[model samples]
Target: MEARDKQVLRSLRLELGAEVLVEGLVLQYLYQEGILTENHVQEINAQTTGLRKTMLLLDILPSRGPKAFDTFLDSLQEFPWVREKLKKARKEAMTDLPAVASVRLPRELSLPAQL
Candidate 1:
């Protein structure tokens, strides 16, 4: 996942932990989507509390590669408010990017210099 997406997840960690039902369909969906491995699901299910399970899920997501964020978002279908909040955060993050960052440099200028 992108750094901005990871940051958004971290920012909403507390809220997510409070609202996520770790023992429910979310984890199964993530596993089925291939975003979470069998081991990952097992680890999360082993957590003693809902909050701990969510925290572990949050911790694991950033390292699960690019599609993890979106797949995870999709798994939140039961929690429309949480999904909306995440979507809004993503939109805000995109808008907050500096205009200069979106401008592509000329090929020659974009090339790396020799050491």
Candidate 2:
């Protein structure tokens, strides 16, 4: 495979795993909180499936040029509110562990004992 194809596959693997896990967690929480109804869950599942179908179609295309690849990249848009909330949460979590920000280990200690 070409470099671009390898990079795209690596990114798709990472993103697909992360999206399914995170969305599953968020959906479960929302359901428990009574924020999402059964119908809402069904609708979200359908949407997620549609997205996967779209990605599969794109992946199976015979030839993809830069423009096609750029379009694919553009489709993976991040939700603004979700991104902001995650950023805020990460900042809060990091604030409680000030020493973690400057963590380091000696080279000898960083490696496994077997090495």
In terms of TM-score, the best-performing candidate is 1
Q: What lDDT score belongs to each candidate, Candidate 1 first?
A: 0.89, 0.44
Against the hidden reference, what TM-scores do the models get? 0.84, 0.28
Task: Give the alpha carbon lDDT tens digit for every residue of 42-112 in model 2.
Answer: 55566556456334433432144434333333333443443444344435554655463776899876978
Q: What is the clash count for each candidate, in the order shown?
A: 0, 0
Model 2, position 93, has a per-residue lDDT of 50
Candidate 1 C-alpha error for residue 86, in Å: 0.5
lDDT (0-100) at residue 109 of candidate 2?
Answer: 67
lDDT of 2: 0.44
What tens digits encode model 1's per-residue C-alpha lDDT throughout 1-115? 9988998998888988899657568999999999999999999989988899999999999999999999988998888899899999988998987776577899877868765
RMSD of 1: 4.0
